[model samples]
Target chain A: LGPVMIVDTPGMDDEGELGLLRIEKCKEVMAKVDIAILVVDGTLGMSDGDRMLKKMFEERNLPYITVYNKLDLVQQRIGKGRTREVPQDSIWVSASDKINITDLKDMVAHLVVDPSNGRKIIADLISEGDIVVLVTPIDEAAPKGRLILPQQQTLRDILDTGAIGVVTQVPQIPEVLASLAKTPALVVTDSQAFKEVNELVPEDILLTSFSMLFARYKGDLGEAILSANYLDKLEDGAKILISEGCTHHRQCNDIGTVKLPKMIEKTTGKNFHFEWSSGDSFPDDLSTFDLVVHCGGCMLNPREMMHRIRICQNAGVPITNYGVIMAKMQGILPRVSAPLLGKK
Target chain B: LGPVMIVDTPGMDDEGELGLLRIEKCKEVMAKVDIAILVVDGTLGMSDGDRMLKKMFEERNLPYITVYNKLDLVQQRIGKGRTREVPQDSIWVSASDKINITDLKDMVAHLVVDPSNGRKIIADLISEGDIVVLVTPIDEAAPKGRLILPQQQTLRDILDTGAIGVVTQVPQIPEVLASLAKTPALVVTDSQAFKEVNELVPEDILLTSFSMLFARYKGDLGEAILSANYLDKLEDGAKILISEGCTHHRQCNDIGTVKLPKMIEKTTGKNFHFEWSSGDSFPDDLSTFDLVVHCGGCMLNPREMMHRIRICQNAGVPITNYGVIMAKMQGILPRVSAPLLGKK
Candidate 1:
């Protein structure tokens, strides 16, 4: 959401066993953050650890701004004691008095947010007057009396872009298309009904799955596309790890733990080992696994999903979501990815 | 050795609950076998399960022959009662009497052993009287007594192919090359010394690592190469799974659990999540991992390693051994792979 994600991390140079672990954890956080704010105690001045961290940031070419905290205390001792030296590019702030806190927020905003970057989701795909169709399948898996996040987000994206959205289930997709005066600018469907929707949509109209769009949005589309090809080379006793964003739904559990595994085994003609994970706490250890199959991640924010993807990429693991994997299995991946392919 | 490995499996289609698990185990064994022998009790005749087992083998297109057991009992009943119907493709054999067992052995030998497959490890790389240099590092990780299995096997392969093998440690590689009488046909090095050995070996000489060759001999080389690229893209907080073949060595523990992770983190400038596994029991649930780094697997047979590789490939996970990863990290992977690349 427009670069508003802020992560508050612990001090990097803590002492003792747990402190050492915290320092390691700080380094991990340091690697993932775009910009870091080093909070320093003004009275104590800068320690060697602070200098080391600043150098670490400089080595990665990661920009960092220092914050001098406890400005109130510094001010209280102004007449009696010497003022501590602050870095040239740093800001002075006090948590107790909220001194220069607004300036800190403004500085962060200036550094991170770029209005010209064009961060809109589907806005680039369609113009103000264009009609966009969304095919949502209402099945046992569908939540009671509510649309899932991805569908809602897609609808909102269309609305925000000033485009008209025609929402319907899989069976009504053909009728909905016929009833419209002009062909929709794009058709996005739930991945489960991708094959059916692909057939119903005309050749000229752009089509893609919701999962694929999310994958592109979340920064793992290339990896998902690349990993889809691996399904063909599976041999006996191959392992496939299936994960989902939400764990409680019976339908997702069935698909992840049972149906998908069965389909993969049958398609490859190989008996495979299957592992399952769900919800937000993704496994940290992934060395034993060969492949990771994730869900559409409707409930997960793009940042979380991207982190998961980045983790996989770093580990040299290939990862794909249910939509892409199923699309590949059904021979409709090329069609679903056509719209994005053109832009690339 | 010469089709000498024999796997004794339990009977399929056994009766009780425990027997059912054994039966499943039998089917797994059957899946890996080149040929199946159905030992039938001559007097009892073929049961429904036996027919089912035969059908299963037929479905897999696995070649099979039937063996009629208790030939002595059949002989005793010859003049007393109606004779059982024996299949045309069956042989009468008695373990106690040792009847027609030699024919069964010959049949197995005829089906499995073929001399023309060129099973030699590096025979294709060298001609008779050619010299090959091996660079082994006798570091802390090296065994106290002798060379590892891959090195020993490579030596044997060279001898079998009428090629001369010149062995040396990392420091002695340059001297060994200078002293050689002729240009060596190939140079192989322990994966740990890949970078150093790569620089010392002449550009014209063929070169490869023990792990890379083992990767090809055991299973998929393409997968390993593709997975190696993933090392370049790892981010901070990425998960890396490191595994070893055997468990007892303190040296491997330090490298796997300590040194390699440190090297990777330092090189990538990103803190990573790490997982470790050792010995014969690999983790079944590999879905949570992003990458798997394995050992050269001297303790593991080619078949087992191949199965592990296939498992990784099928799951769409990228895998590399310690050597390939280190070589790539050290910028020596291309030089080491040059010889194999030429063949390709």
Candidate 2:
């Protein structure tokens, strides 16, 4: 259940005007995968494109399985009992005929590295039936009538581990804590409300933010913390980039555009030039920016977030997510980073 | 495979501050369904809320199957194999115990109104191995490197029906047709290129647009075509509403904002006031508009589109889709509507 998920790519050798773009896409996909599966046509055997794909996997030290499909056609040509020679450790199957598909599934399952070997949200810290309080602030920036993806995903993870998630807003935390029959195991809050919630929750209880958990899950949390340390070094008129993963109409009190910028200006006490990019458009050339502050990346896939992180790393720019930045600005970076470091 | 898809709704008796909105959502869902399944707790029997839900379903003349869950608890209370009174035609089972779940599935399959019994895309006209030509225009509005949803769904339908789909751009349609060993059974194009495609496709070969076919499949084609007839009745300075199911930055040559308006002005030679709405903000009150021209609605679900159509119908306003209007303006509405009507 804790196995890594697979990323599907397009047909590699679509030899036309856009073939190069498709190949470029494949290379990007290759950067994020730990293993690869090469599907080949049984009738046509392996082509040059397949060989190049295999080489790419091998160059990256990715263990891969070669799957020969359309076994029905081969069976029809040479009769059912006849077996043709295939690559060693390759799987031959017919999707339509239901031939050896289960074996292929088992092989894929066996190849997955344990995805939970690294940091986890709460499974290692708490056990079944433990109570975890989640503090979500209902503000102008919140989507109407629904919780955002990060909170929903974190709650789902806790449920999966058989833990009870007690949801409350920032204002109700004091009342919720008083009403609870037993002391809660941990308190997680939206980073925007960190200052107030940090003050409300007792120092004895474990506390964190959704963004901090996700940063460690899908991105480099240690690096994010290290980069956030650069916030105090910014000079007046230093260029900063603010990137959001999703684009929606900016509300009156939108956290990304309004609240975060205000916090940064207040903390640094220096006016800086700010550039903004949202939805899929991340600047490849990060050389111009003193710092890059990205969203918590709930809308983005793990691979895409990782790719963006690597791009920032390669560009030698200090990159930190919204939550990490806010936590650092609140002077709670060491306190929050303590819980995650133990799990790591 | 013929099972009726489950519609997961909020807890019916959510009697709290937002209960009115929840009830409104339920009524909207009820309008689109033929039958309802009321699941209740076995131990609790029928509550007032359950009775209300049943009455609502009955008022709409919807057949319902009452499913009493947690039968295991009831059995433990009353002793196993002892009969207890239940409503006629009611099912009692435990979900956690995996009891009578198959019976529930069979009931759902039996209740399905055979969704495909009414409208189909292209499967009715073409047989196995028949060739169909698809003309797509790669323009600025096109998503970076993939076919739009309608085109992808149509191509998939063709493949599912065992028909061959030949894909080409607007410029290559001529070469593709000439190079084909056998004449294609049909030619379909993007509605934006209907003028040129209608001219290029032979008179003998059946021709249609993606939007036209989708209107019939996902929406009301007959009503759409009928509403298109109302375009001639518009006067100078008449109010018209243009609604798109999704929003994007309108490119210089985008169909919805630029091309459609241009076509309307040229065809009618009467300037009209235009009101635009995009992305799920359909007006409930349409009395101000003379006509409503909507997108093909590939992004919208069938229920949502039908709800919008019903709103327009209730307002006594003529509502039509983009493809139907364009075909009518081009004087090809009769030709395109012919193929769909035979099946209708």
Candidate 3:
């Protein structure tokens, strides 16, 4: 019972429309669980319905333990040791007297297995005491009173690695660089300010963006880079889906809805059909679209993000994010992603 | 005006406590914007407050356009063609008469820049018509009525890539493999079933788990693998944070709260202080913990997920997820992650 979900499903032997519906619901619930517990009335032993349930669990490869409840009644009726046969893994318990419940709980806990992995932001890229410069341009779209999640996280990662992080704005990059004792180990800028920061930061120092770092950290960097090339292949009337992970209030000049579409059209010099999707609902079928351009997924979990990428992959459609596309369009994709990608 | 957010803040010249607080709020608003529109009264021309606001914009590198409103009043008072000098980008308009608004909107749109990149699931791994076997063990935790997001996504990705995905349960995996015309290009199982699936799948064929693929797709697989080794380094009384991205109803036998903690304790043979965090609130200060074990982050966006990783990295704490840890604990990490990592 510890950390385990106990679903009290409807009787498997129920009949008629409502009963059938209940059984159907039970089946649906059955599809998702890791372990099953079949509680049987000990006096009656296993019924046909219980057998069907057991078979269902077996077919699904579900590990289960049978619980024979009302053990006192069974014991009294069968004279103790003469009780009916049961599965080896089955346990006998008296619900009223609380018999063998602890044993049942232990068995259940043992069957509940863990399935999981881990990650890092930029901690691996630099050494202790290394100076890391971050160019965060405060604009109308910047969050009020604090840095956005990505910036705060990047700086924290630097601190975690025992490294120095020099935070500055776009216009102050040159001054920040000039004031440094030695060339910083890495210069990470907001994707929107990459072009300006690229010119200001020395050619020898490694440079990247919050978006680019996230592209690799939370998603597939290599696939995003490859998909960026799809921009060139876009033909007239090509279909594109512009997807944003979170549905924040639309600003007058929202990047995903306005600027990105405009940029895509202007860059390709081709007319195309543009579609937009926001929040948790991504279309199941992505095959209709020639390309999918997504925002840096700050709001979505890794599994959802990867699922999206998988959807695009299955559809045979190329997908890129706002940062990678902007870098590619600005002709700095390679230069900005170099530090993270471990390439020149 | 299209998709742009217009925040009307208190006067920049405001003084005193409440007034200063209003101005502080205004400054907070200014930090997040892409562009600024300074509306000056034509009758008043440019006041000292206006100059200060413009200077703030310039210092922050915010592109702005000034509008001289009540042009009719200014022209009537000062005579036509005798207006006060203004910046080159300033526009003269009569607000009541709806003058030059289109041009102002265009200017604002021109200032909004797109900053973004992009991903894939298993579509990148399997080819068209390739048979990919999926071993999903249905248990009590399975969601009612439909497949979980990850499974649905993987299946969809298979269809998208023009590949054949044979979905089966763990007990039926042997039959599934036996029935196949030839060896499947890959066999992906739930991480919980990795041990059994690892034994069943042939060494000649590629094998991995959905969690392993996602670890790479949505996060750093190498980092996860490295962090998994940290399990061996855990000492008695070491603090561990078991973080989950979403806060679903805790089942009687919840994996994160019950199974995982118990498993860690059993595997390490050490007593540890375990803490928990779920949903959007990850502790900003994670330095107190020796290690952080996180869920796969299906509910969190990539940015937030990566941010948590960054936080852990910054805290100098080793972090691993449910899938990777399970594989590691079961001694099947190498076998389960091989196909995705491109090594055996």
Candidate 4:
């Protein structure tokens, strides 16, 4: 049994058309996606990308729901005489406020999935008491007092599965596994730390990242993570483009710049030339690059992200995002994502 | 001899692909533009659009100076860990910050028209005795106790012209002209008040709006205003999309909503299905409509706006923005846009 999730991406900003890439990646996975969650800013209402993604889902017949995020910013808009809007097939929920999260999950209960894809909804994925270990790093970008939205959502999803969830960091994972009498059913680590977790964990232990699950849930796991294979084919000094969605609190030691480059160098053991572009500086032509590594794109629209992926494909460049690449590099490419990407 | 001016546009969230559009449009008017005033937001560093515009200027071999606007917002960004960024060929001045207006004009003293266009720099176009009447409508959208940025810029442009700027409302323009001994050289009305002002101005006077000047400044004046000719040919029930560039100060009885619609209806004198979309909502298929009425698109990148225009062109739908449409409707299209758009 496994869990299904969705990732709503932001606009083309935060990396020139990075959202477009994610949208293309999402479409690749949409065929098997169990639940499509569209996240939008309540203050801005539905953006061009939001409406475009919804149209994409309608065309694809994806079972999707919408979450109006950032309701805390509502008072300001309301003070200005603007009303909060929930467009069709959507519910308002502030990711920070944790409002209506229960309703959100409950709606997922009646949600339909692609029968051929055999995506086991969380209800069918796990029985009570299955062990789920969340491996997250306490990095500078990690908020001071609390975990970020995606981490919190994953923990909640794990709890909803009735799975016994244990949270640990990459360094603590080997010790945590030593003490566990039974191997955990699943280990979801921060994508940034997935490589090390994979090295220490046994081959049988389930390993994945929130992003990997997101890729599978959104129906892009294979096409997205497969870009990691590009590492082998890349020419020496080849240009690589990496992009992320959010700009706020973008740390100086960003994974897009520091860790991912190190990982690629370690995985291929080659000093591959890299060009790091973030927030909305996505280059127009992706053809020049050997491969493109992208972030989760939580803040971007799914359509724009997909458009970017299609651009890479059209340009004949291999493209993958953080989590999918992490899962592949971490060596749990299958068991971690098989439940969702696998054919029935 | 009126004050002829050029305007630099702002980027639409995604809609203002004006940078790319202008590049293509510039190909037609590269030799025609009298001055190129490159614009950059004072708060948001040199954006991709800005870079693209700069590249276009370089490629076209156009003489351009930069205008860094929104100085008031610059300080706000400083506190938010953001600092002022100035690209070359640009001067940093807050259009909002008083007393720097003269400095902007002084910088413009260096403008050199592309020799091919044969258009003279605006500063040389003005005569000492010409009375330049500016029709400024203080609408709800107008900031409290202050004129809009465009108005303020126009006033400065008038002073630089050495033409006496006779400021008045549309209703008072006739009286002001009568009071003056000589026929005014030009009458620049707010695009929203073009119809009323058009009738009051004599044939010898130049008539235009800021939007018209912007169209010329962006090097697409003729093409944009030409789209308005198709208004009469539009099907009765044919869809018409009206889109604005940004989401700023949507005043009650906004010009986009109230005046543009009323004026268009009065000019066409026929009912047509109308759909109003603002901000970055323009989809790729503008061909579904008989005509697309767009705003000045000051807030969008030229590439994005051109994308819409190209879409409509490909779809066989005529597209015109606010000022262009207004001029055409008044039957004084060429005259209103003439000084800047050329003696059409």
Interface RMSD of each: 36.8, 27.0, 25.2, 35.0
Model 1, residue pairs in steric clash: A286-B289, A287-B241, A289-B286, A290-B317, A291-B315, A314-B234, A315-B291
Cα deviation in Å at residue B225, candidate 4? 75
Candidate 3's residue-wise lDDT over A1-344, tens digit each?
22334568877767678877977776655644557898888877789888988998898777889999998787787776454666779988888878788988888877764311145678789876576777766565654324466765676566556565555666656655555456678888888887788788878888888888887777788889999978998889999999988787453129888888898889888999999998766887998999998898875545457768988998999888998999999899888888877631
For residue A42, give model 1's deviation from the true position in Å. 2.5
Best by TM-score: 2
Q: Give TM per candidate.
A: 0.45, 0.48, 0.39, 0.35
Report the C-alpha lDDT of model 2 over A23-89, residue by residue, as the tens digit: 8778867765656899998899998889889988888766799999889999999999565788676
Sort by TM-score, best first: 2, 1, 3, 4
Candidates in descending lDDT order: 2, 3, 1, 4
Poorest lDDT segment (10 consecutive residues) of candidate 2 chain B: B138-147
Comparison by lDDT, 2 against 3, better one: 2
Instruction: Quote the lDDT for B252 in model 4.
Output: 25
Q: Quote model 3's TM-score for chain B.
A: 0.68
TM-score between model 4 and native: 0.35
Q: Which digits, one per residue and each the tens of the lDDT, describe model 2 over residues B54-134?
A: 989888766788899998888898987553677766788789988888987777667654443466677777876666777
Q: Cα lDDT of all candidates, in order?
A: 0.72, 0.77, 0.74, 0.63
lDDT of 4 by residue, A203-287 (tens): 7776667786655543355678578766677776888888765566465237788878888789877787888766555666877
Maximum-lDDT candidate: 2
For model 1, the superposed segments whose C-alpha errors exceed 4 Å read: A1-6, A28-35, A52-63, A79-89, A114-120, A138-146, A244-255, A278-287, A297-311, B1-344
